[model samples]
Target: MTVTATLAGLDPTTLGDALRVAGSPGFDRWQDQIRRTGGCSDPIHLTGTTVTRDRDTGQVLHSYSTEAEPGGRLRVACGNRRASRCPSCAWTYAGDTYHLIRAGLTGDPAKGTPHTVRNHPRVFATLTAPSFGPVHNRPGRGHRPCRCGIHHPADAPELGTALDPAAYDYAGAVLWNNHAGHLWRYVTIYLPRELAKCAGITQRELRERLRISYGKVAEYQKRGAIHFHAVIRLDGPDGPDTAPPAWATRDLLTNALRTAAARAEVALPAVGDQPARVLRWGTQLDVQAIGAFGHGEDLTEQAVASYVAKYATKAAEATGTVDRRIGELSELDKLPDLPDHTRRLIRACRDLDALYPDRKLWQWAHMLGFRGHFSTKSRRYSTTLGALRQVRADYRAAQQRAALGLPDPDDHPEATTLTLAHWAYAGHGHTPGESWLAATIARDIQHNRDTAREHRAALDTAGEW
Candidate 1:
């Protein structure tokens, strides 16, 4: 497992490229930049200069430039949330999502949420799409054979593919995905009314006495359909900080959610030869009460947070499709060994795009016609991703300032510091050798994190004993 031995096995061109980077005088500095970006697969290249000066005295305090850096450029993380695009950035995104969801459930004082939120009536609900047609699947309970008369393995490639492609309603499935976000919006709108009805009160009175807060993430099923998993909480009118009304209970919330989901529907007008359709949630609905501690069937705060975070970094790639946008129908043919079911789904998107210009099906063909944000939250759902990122940015900036021996901006308020900066995009992506090196660094970082997490878990278990 030596670096030299690993390099020896690489192709000649890659070996030569790696050796060139290793031999460069600025190699260490370049490595540091890569480390800072967490080994982003496709980093953005920038050329910039920044000068900070005292506002009162007009005295220059600090200055930075890429003039002396490797390649006269700075490398920054692309910050794409899709794991298929960039795993390092996606890992960071997932971590933020975990904290955001956790704060709303268990509460994080530092993130401005009080611990009282954990006592609030909360439920984890999964909303699924109505089936368009029969597909090959593993039957629940009994080990039944598929419609084609064969017991499929867990990893079978044809698991989600239609038993008969001609019989599958590809257009209906794609249309449902395109309007999934709208359906969720309708559910939110109908939720409070349902809740009020259960309490024998009007929707207006419910709004005055209580508020509904939620955090949700969309996950793609193997059938290329979009489903939602949400953490819904009943909060006071003002939000999580205040106590909910006496009438607010887990059972009531659960019942309201079930009713709201059933009532929320989207209507689509006829397109071409397609008939007018009404889209609604599937019969399979799961609503479970969240417990402070996972006891028996109850899902714990930690487990729910982890589950939602897991899918925040995923897209339609789980359905055996490409990650990037598909420009033309002709391009689908050029794709390497594209699955037949996936190809049809993509083709459906293209076909409908012309008739439904507003839906932008072609633009989201890669996503199987689903274009909504993967992760979303109500305004009162604890902290936000932007705020979490800002905290990290501020901390890193403070560290850099300390390293440069610059006075803290907070320390000298009498003389305010003015920062001026300008940056232009250069090129991006790594050389073949650099890609290998970056992958190695990413793996190392992940391994270290995994080891630390396992160690902490072991200590916790030992303490319990």
Candidate 2:
């Protein structure tokens, strides 16, 4: 068959481009690059040269350049943590988050946490934003009608929409999202003081005797407000490596968290016509002890870790908003399908930005004015995301070194090697055909992961039996 005939069924625009790529000698190399990035949807293209040499003798240890790669550029994962932006990178990020949280709850010797942490007083606490106004909701078990007087279906588009849009406090809701991070900081400060009160000691004495460590992830409620789910732990003064003092009990930790959350508040000065406001956590505080293993009415360590990791890859997009920054109010007009409630919230951000320029509300209007990391942890909570990423990078580097027959860095402890590299961003993303292939690779990789996980789970179940 003729080449044109063979390509007839393919997408018209990408067919010629696909043919050109497939006919090229660098086709395999391009595919290899995509595979190396785990098929990132928007891989960054970089042009660079790197050289590793012995410091003293200046002996060349390794040399590499992107000039030999496909199109004389190297493609790397963008490492975006938002699943709406890049699922492959987000999946990797979620895995790292899971391990980081798990290590804190159950401990991991490799991550510098001792198993004794499982015995530490740990609680899974959820801090929610106060109600701006009543909204449509499914009172799941109670079978009660919404305040607006209707039973909404599970998939109703209006579920989270305001029952009375005109009366809803859009300004307050967005402002709360903007100051959510600040409110969390207040909680941290008050938490220690509350702990001191529970132990019948002064704040100064509490610092020397005990420490509070936690890993928290911010989640967007359907109503576009930010809420926090955290695994709060009480550790000895030295951290997870040491056991907490006798006075530090699980009940003590839970009570302290409840009191701290109640007392935590952020006072915002009046901006223009906007009135002064004090933001505090919602009254619906949920604090539950984390069990070492799954049991009746107790959250398991693994369950809590998985729950936090799941949200780590999400953002305000969960509230039916755009995943990227809203360039201007005009952009909102272009999205005809955007929920009216969400549109009003975006408008609130744009309007507030004029008075509160420092908050950069307009710049983050897409996020409903939230401008904080979705996931965060205290210093002694567990290993950091950076540490987890570095471990993966080091492992990959070691594998590459082994493949190239290079000596391990540990082998030449006294002989230091210096690396010099310069990289310039060329571009990003892929052509239509390349995107199709990359998506296929991503699906295959995910499938492999799922299969491996299921196999291990089956083995564990059998062992339990």
- Which candidate ranks first by TM-score, i.e. highest? 1
Candidate 1 structure quality by residue, lDDT tens digits, 336-438: 6788889999999998998999999999999999999999999998999999999999999999989977778788666577889999999998999888888
lDDT of 2 by residue, 303-344 (tens): 999999999999987678999987768987889989999999
Count of backbone clashes, every candidate in sequence? 0, 0
Listed in order, each prediction's TM-score against the native is 0.97, 0.94
Taken over the whole model, the C-alpha lDDT of each candidate is 0.91, 0.89
Give the runs in model 1 whose Cα sits over 4 Å from its true position.
Answer: 294-298
Each model's RMSD to truth, in Å?
1.8, 2.8
Looking at model 1, residue 107 earns an lDDT score of 90
Error of 1 at 222 (Å): 0.5
